[model samples]
Target: MAAYESAIQSRVDCIEIDVSRSSDEVLFTLHGRQGFTTDIRKHKF
Candidate 1:
């Protein structure tokens, strides 16, 4: 979690995170196959 916070604190303009789509057309941000970070998927429009 600190890694992600540090990345944000660095004022990065853009970030690249892996995303996957669900059957309901929802998008999720995942670091790897079994690692998931924050629940950004719920905020997707």
Candidate 2:
């Protein structure tokens, strides 16, 4: 993912995977409860 790539480029020690589950019960990595671009904070993350 681009985020992981960016973190690696920036020399980050580790990257956070903000995980959650979908309605179908599959796990996914995202910051907000909603899908991509749900919240203003999502932009920062």
Candidate 3:
């Protein structure tokens, strides 16, 4: 979240991020190469 805040503070036109929703219905950013294909719902945060 700090990174997002920093980007906003920096006045950047756009920011890129990876987002995923867990089975528990939680929303958060997903990082790493494996995250692209991995199903976060199967894993616990």
State which candidate has the highest TM-score: 2
Q: What is the lDDT of candidate 1?
A: 0.70
What lDDT is reached at residue 33 by model 2?
A: 43
* Poorest 10 consecutive residues by lDDT, candidate 1: 32-41
Regions of candidate 2 where Cα sits further than 4 Å from its true position: 31-45
* Residue-level lDDT for 33 in candidate 3: 49
Candidate 3 clashes between residue pairs 3 or more apart in a chain or in different chains:
none
Per-residue C-alpha lDDT of model 1 across residues 1-45, encoded as one tens digit per residue: 555567699997666677899999999876543556555557966
List candidate 3 stretches off by more than 4 Å.
30-45
Q: How good is model 2 by TM-score? A: 0.54
lDDT of 3 by residue, 1-45 (tens): 786788789998876788899999998895454546655458985
TM-scores of the candidates are 0.40, 0.54, 0.48
1-43, model 2: which lDDT tens digit per residue? 7767777999977777778889999998864345654444457
